[model samples]
Target: MRESRFIAVKLISVLKPVIDRRRRLALIVDDTLMARSCSKKTELLAKVYDHDKHEVLTGYRGLTVGWSDGNTFLPVNFALMSTKKKENMIGNQPVTADQRSIAGRRRTQAQRPMNAVTVELLKQTKKVYYRYRDRLYDVKGLYERLAAAKTRQ
Candidate 1:
């Protein structure tokens, strides 16, 4: 995760010049499905609404954010959407004790209502961005301090 964050920071830095020149950049948010229909025993398998398909598909929904410049898209962050509640729409059937326990662990970070998942995804992305932003400022401050010390000598 940390590595991915650092890579995002690097990517943003590389794109900064073009972004500034165009003065237009988009932060895209999207959710996608990773179907697991063949595996009935797959952990956290649930009904996920596919907006484009206009139907509920049995799979995992992945909410992700990315930066785009009308052409190129750079994925910044992502979070898996899981419906682990006892009364979800599709996965209404009861599971055995062992399956329940496994599903519980799989749904540890479960968020509801789609909107909640989007909010969580944005929050996580914001966190990573701020962390890198702060680190950049710290480095700038250090550079300034070093330059001042050199001038004094």
Candidate 2:
């Protein structure tokens, strides 16, 4: 599907029975370094701290959120993060400020704090839950319908 929120909502619903049995539910948030050192043309590539290797690495950080009732864990949402603090340029070559394009603007916005990104993901999850909680159709049916609609175009 085009929207990840819908899939997240479905996954959450499937795990609802397991979650409801527990007295407390925990939302887990974490960021992982996806190594892409061989890539030179990737946008938003930056130096990310790798906890496992105890060193800095070049790659993108994927921030994710999941729900756990101490047993069953379900990933709900995620966002790619970057540390590209400045506009893209041709290696050390001088460029005017007017040369910054839409990609540069997006890179700056993608540098948001981890907490802010987590909060945004949680808000989206809550919204998806409330909007579809009362629905009766299964996820398979919903996806099939969506597929059919796409083919009609």
Candidate 3:
């Protein structure tokens, strides 16, 4: 099936007011992993990476994202974290030495953090969806980055 067009009800300029009024936009950031092509169950392996010089524990991971109602949990956003999981994402050395241990590298990746993803996800939530449960339909047009930008403004 083909996805439809996404219309952002809230504009970026107005988001600050919405957030300030409610204190928070009700966001939750997490990971979820779908099976990679031609792969079975997820495995725990310290796979050597081409980009980063060290091996990372690769269980074919992604983010399990959603949102919360202060005291309650409701899924609003689900952004699959970039699995490349590099150090440049963090304020650390952009290179890794093969001589390094898996523990050392993963520590760096974890430290890199997902603050950017969190921010973008929240923004996407406000822009794309009017209400959480109300948007079970696939949003369109937004898949096109340039088009989405025009709508956000």
Candidate 4:
């Protein structure tokens, strides 16, 4: 049999069991910092900016979206966000939730893709999701999107 690049995966038909035992499997999304970059010899740090003051106010911050498999947490999404620049602090300063996007209304939006390792990890991560078929093929096309992002990288 010839080997195909993409696996012909079938959606499994099983509801997630509510087992109280620790052996119950769950999804785990994790991100590890490879390194950091800085100007001069300044110390590199992972800091989430202050949402109000819009400043890099020390300490590590990143978003990792996960899915609970009725037992444990499974990381399904992770985004490494760059610190928002304090640009135009005087013009349209302090953007609130209802505030419009700085880029303004859009007609044709850009398709920014994802990284490669994320793609491979996502590919290897789908086995946990087969139990979700009755909940709708909720994770459909996730792998393709991840692969596209890898190619973009």
lDDT tens per residue, model 3, 64-87: 334443444445554433333343
Better candidate number, 3 or 4, judged by TM-score = 3
Which rank order by TM-score, best down to worst?
A: 1, 2, 3, 4
Tens digit per residue, CA lDDT, model 2, 1-99 = 116767766776777765555346666666678987777666567767787788877777776666656676666667777764554321221222232
At residue 24, what lDDT does model 1 achieve?
52
Name model 4 segments beyond 4 Å from true: 1-15, 18-44, 50-53, 62-65, 69-121, 127-129, 133-153
Instruction: Tally clashes: model 3.
Output: 9
Candidates in order have lDDT scores of 0.59, 0.58, 0.38, 0.34
Candidate 3 wrong stretches, greater than 4 Å = 1-25, 32-56, 85-113, 129-153
Q: Candidate 4: deviation at residue 4, Å?
A: 29
Looking at candidate 1, the ten consecutive residues that score lowest on lDDT are 131-140
Pick the lDDT winner: 1
Write the number of the candidate with greater lDDT, choosing between 1 and 3. Answer: 1
Model 3: residue 22 alpha-carbon error in angstroms: 13
Error of 3 at 60 (Å): 3.5
Better of 1 and 4 by TM-score: 1
Where is model 3 poorest over a 10-residue stretch in terms of lDDT? 1-10
